[model samples]
Target: MPHLVILYTSQLDGETDMSALCRHLADTMLTLRDEAGKAVFPTGGVRVLAYPAAHGATTDGSGDHAFCYLNLRMARGRSADVHRRTGEALVAAARAHFAPLLAGRAIGLTLQVDEGAEVFDGKFGNLHPLFTPP
Candidate 1:
């Protein structure tokens, strides 16, 4: 199977709710199915992990590095387009929820795939990608 990681960074902290944000992203992931017409979650085919910015990770309006990170898992046969679409969906979600605070800041969203030895070795592991943009 292929694994996906989505990293989003924001500029505001006090106004954000990380738990709700995680739920929203999780729900969104559940709504996406593969070409085989299978539900991604609860079938062992999809998994999502969300992370909110750590307390004191940033300060001041200009120093805030508030972020939400999501990791997704899917079958290896999935295409990059599918991953891209998923990333776009996350961006849209962010825009709807945090546009005002993120506006004019260094907000970013990125999606990536992981196909490691374990992935091809018919075993699942606990590896996830990290936010890479500075």
Candidate 2:
């Protein structure tokens, strides 16, 4: 399972091409790795998802609003605060990276995180450390 998953969609326009979006996403992933390196999550482990706009969706009819979503998964043993922080980081990354492309356009971004039970030694199943004492 990936620690981070970033999903982004933008209006297909002259300014916002798929290649540019991909590059931006890649840069964001690098930034994420750098940030994670300073923290507990494994570095260079962030995974991003690419979701193209719905079929036949056009920038003219759709009003050129980009939708970005990010999802993160982490060990359940950690506190909810950690997950919250991760979500914030993901949001910040989107805002910082896509701000230029989203300029003068309606853009929406969301973040969701799932916390799973911690697996230790591969023999024991997920034991939510937050709920159960070690």
Number of the top-ranking candidate, with lDDT as the measure: 2
Enumerate clash totals for all models, in the order shown.
Answer: 0, 0
Q: Tens-digit lDDT track for model 2 on 4-71?
A: 55556535344455455445544554454323354445334434555655544434664655666666
Top TM-score model: 2
Name the lDDT value of residue 61 in candidate 2. 64
Where is model 1 more than 4 Å wrong at Cα? Answer: 1-13, 41-47, 52-75, 104-115, 119-134
Q: Please report how far candidate 2 places residue 12 from its true position, in Å.
A: 5.5
Runs off by more than 4 Å, candidate 2: 10-38, 54-62, 117-134
Please give the lDDT score for candidate 1: 0.52
Residue 30 local lDDT, model 1? 61
TM-scores, one per candidate: 0.54, 0.56
Per-residue lDDT tens digits of candidate 1, residues 1-134?
Answer: 33334444533335666556656766676676656776543323344544444443434557545555555555455566666766677666656666765675555444444433342455555432222223
How displaced is residue 104 in candidate 1, in Å?
A: 7.2
